[model samples]
Target: MKVLVIGATGYAGHRIATALRRRGHDVTGLTRDLAGAGARALAAAEIRPVAGELADPAGYREHLWDADVVVHTAMDYADPAGSDRALIAELVAAPRHLVYTTGISLHGRVDTPELDEESPSSPDNPLHFRYQLERELIASGLPHTIVRPAFLYGHDSRTSQLGRWFAAPRFVGDKDKRWSFVHVDDLAEAYVRIVERADAPLGDIFVIGEENPPPALEVFTAAFRAAGHAGEVTVHPISPEEWLEQAADQDERVNSAKARRELGWTPRHAGPIAGMATYYAAWQAANA
Candidate 1:
């Protein structure tokens, strides 16, 4: 299948593009600037890049004929609803299916409690905006798949939540900070399987996660250990909203059972501690 990964330059979309291409599909990456990071990342991965803004329907529609599936990993952080409303019509009309990426943050905060697709979601956090986008798209009657992934962790300096701690051990109070997680590569592969599976049901929301998501404190401690700064680690007064700050109150657990049962997605990275160690090593190598 010819796949178009909108926001192909991003952490998730870029990986998805490469994964599909490696699997022998013709993959195209759509990014804001052909000369920008997304384009460069796609080019580096050998996925064809199309320079276009997702908000402008006409900007990408010309190439729509070439895409059998369109995966939207672009999050319009500002005005996500308007962006969704603008593109939903065009996106649904073109592709056989559209894959929308949402995150476990939508489920709000949970401390090791198992939550699935049927669980209720909290709309009071930052994800409230994207939740609106998800609703609008699902109601469009388009053959669409919603992929809700846990916190994404990887070597990418921009996304690795471990980066700040690894650079230097800092004191964060309490271990209450917790979050569900999925390795970036694993999350990307889940998207690929969702598209490849012919029987994947439309309007199905798949939460992609692993068997265990480490507590926020453990993840930070692991990062410090990986960086040889574990000795300096200290905990004092960690904010309840440790990652996203006070306004972004979230501590959540989400399971990817649906993705595993239907799409056959088996995430390779199991333990967050070990994953953070590996991610730290990769970050050091890339930054070196």
Candidate 2:
């Protein structure tokens, strides 16, 4: 299979691209800079790097049409809705399988014990646009699969924000608010399974995360300890609405049984707390 990974230089994108290449697929990585470090790194891994922009389909539409599969991991935080909307519009006409990346945050605050792909999305959440995007992509009648991963950690993941808090070791919202997590490498494997399974139904949605989720207090405490901090972690209280606005601070517990049953995907790594020490070291190396 020939695969083209957009935003291939990013944390999750890079890992997904490499995993596909390792599986003997012809993989091409689309990035903004073809001569920069990320593109060079992709080339080093034997994945072709092509210069492109998510906002401008003309830059990457040819590559998209050329691939047997197209995985979109690119995100424009400045204009996420606009960029993603543009990409989805272009993907509607492409004759290929699409593995679109959406975050578990789209589920909003997990008021129930747990939620899955069938759960209703909370439009109150700041990232409600993503839920709308997911709907748009599905209704487009494209051969696509949507993956909503929980907080991604491992291997220099800035998204996890563990490194930022390692210095002070604190929980900014409800300490007991639980959140789901997945190692980047494990998430990559989920994508590999999705791509390899040719029989997967269109508009399928998969929630990717480890089995059990821990509270904010537990996650940060483990991260601090892993980074060799012996001090007590500070707690800061905030309103529930404020928490929801932060997105990362709200409860994000989710069930991945559907992914396991349908895609045969199993996360090999224990949750973040179990492997924080090693993950901390990897983050340090990547940042250094």
* Candidate with best lDDT: 2
lDDT of 1 by residue, 7-109 (tens): 7887778888898999989899987788876687788887999878777767778776578888888877666667667777886666458888877676554
Which residue pairs in candidate 1 have backbone atoms (N, alpha carbon, C) closer than 3 angstroms, thus clashing?
9-38, 109-251, 110-251, 110-252, 173-236, 173-237, 173-238
Candidate 2 structure lDDT: 0.83
Q: What TM-score, computed on C-alpha atoms, does each candidate reach?
A: 0.87, 0.94
Candidate 2 regions with alpha-carbon error over 4 angstroms: 237-245
After best superposition, candidate 1 residue 235: deviation in angstroms? 4.9
Per-residue alpha-carbon lDDT of model 2 for 143-235, expressed as tens digits? 899999887888886645666655546668767778888888999999999999967677789999986677867888888888788876788
Measure candidate 2: CA RMSD: 2.1
User: Which residues of candidate 1, in runs, are more than 4 Å off?
Assistant: 110-112, 167-174, 230-243, 246-248
